[model samples]
Target: MAERVVPEGQRRRRRPTKQGAVLSERLIIDTALRLVTQHGADALSVRRLGTALGADPSSLYRYFRNTDDLLLRLADEFIGLAQEGFTPSGDWRADLRDMGLRIHGVYVENPQVALLAAHRTTGRAHETAAVEKILGILRGAGFPDPTAVRLYHAFVDQALAFAALDAAAQALPTPAREADEEVWLSSYGRLPPDTHPNVAATFPLLAADMRDSGYPFALDLMLEAAEARLRG
Candidate 1:
C-alpha cells in the first residue's frame, strides 16, 4: 500500500482491498456483520477478518484494537438499525409496543450483535437517543419524572432481555435447535400420566406452542402490567 495521507487526530482507518475496493470503518463493520451472521459470533477473529477482507490481518489493527472494539461498534450499529422508523405517536402503549417490536426484530435478525450488547451499555449516540425517546414517551403519557425514568428502565430492559433470549434460540445451529423441540415432542410429550400427570395432560399444548421463542408473549405481558400500573 502507498503512503496514503490520513487526516490528523482521526481514528478512521482507510486502505485498499485486494480487489481495489476502498476499506473504511463502515466497510469493516459491514464485513464483520456478514462474518458473524454467516458463521456465528465466535468466527470473528483478526486472521479470519483479513481473509474476508482480502488484506493482511495486521491491516485491521489500524482500525480496531481488538475484537471487543469491533463488537461494540457492530452493536452500536445494531442500535441504530433497531430504532429506525421508530416514531412516537403520543399513545404511550401502542407507540411503545411498536418500538419494542422493532428492537426485538433487529435483535432476531442480528443475533451476534445482540449478544455483544446483551450485558454492556455502549453509551453511543444511538443508544443515548433511544433512551431519550423512551423516557420522553413515558413522561408525555403523564408519568412523573422519577416514575417515567423507572418505567423506562424496566420497559427497555424487558425488551432487551427477551430479545437476547430469542436471539440465543436463533444462534443455535439448525440441527441442535430442532432437536430441542423434538425432545419436547417425543420425550416430554410422551411422559406417563402416572408420574407426570401435568406433563402428559398439557403435552399437546406444549408441543404446539413450545416452538416459539415467546418474545411477543413476554413483551405484551410486560406492557400490559405497565399499563395497569399507570392506570392504578
Candidate 2:
C-alpha cells in the first residue's frame, strides 16, 4: 500500500478534535500568540499548541506548514495589529512618526512576539501593506525613487531594531529588569567627576531619561534627518 501525498496549494480537510474544538488558521495563530505571551516564545511548539487548543498535534499542518511557517504568520499578525485603524494625516513627518510609534508600542506590548519575530521578513499581506504605505508617503513627499527606497529601508530597520531591543528589556524578569534600570542611578550617576567627567556631567540627564524607552527620541532624530534630506 502507498501512503497519501497532499498536493501543493491545498490543505487537508479540517475536522473537530477529540475535545470538540474546530481549529482554523486564525484560532491557531491566536492560540500560538497567547502561548508565546504566557509561556515565552520557546513554548510555541506544535505539541504545546495542540495541547492548548485541545487538537491533535498533527492537525496544525492543515493550516501551517511547520513552526517556522506559523511564526511568519504570527509576525504578519503583529504588523497587522500595529497598522490597524491607522490613517495617514498627509503630513509625511507626522504620518511616519505615528506609524513608528505604533510599531514600537505594539511590539512592547507583545514583548515575546517582538523578541522572536521582529527580525523576520514575513513577506505577507500586512508586511506588504506597511512597505507600500511607507514608500508611498516618502515618494509623495518628493523623495526620488532611490532616495525613497533608502529612507524606507532606514526607517523600517530603525523601528524594528529599537523595538526588538526594547522588547528584550521588557521581557526580562522583574527583578533583573529593575536591577538593570537601577544601574544608572546606582553606578553611573555616582561616578566621580575627576575621573569620569562626561559621565558625571551627564548623570543628571541620564537618570531622568534612562527610565523610558529611547525609541521615540531615536525616531525623532531619523525623521529630522529625513526632513533635512528632503530640504536639500
**lDDT of each model, Cα atoms only?**
0.80, 0.89
Tens digit of per-residue lDDT, candidate 2, span 195-224: 999989888898889899888999999999
Which regions of candidate 1 fall more than 4 Å away from where they truly are? 1-15
Instruction: Give the Cα error of residue 202 in candidate 2, in Å.
Output: 2.2
Residue 74 lDDT (model 1): 80
Worst 10 residues of 2 by lDDT: 1-10
Using Cα atoms with residue i matched to residue i, what is each candidate's TM-score against the true structure?
Answer: 0.87, 0.93
lDDT (tens digit, per residue) of candidate 1 on 93-126: 8888898888888998888767767666878888
Over 4 Å off, model 2: 1-15
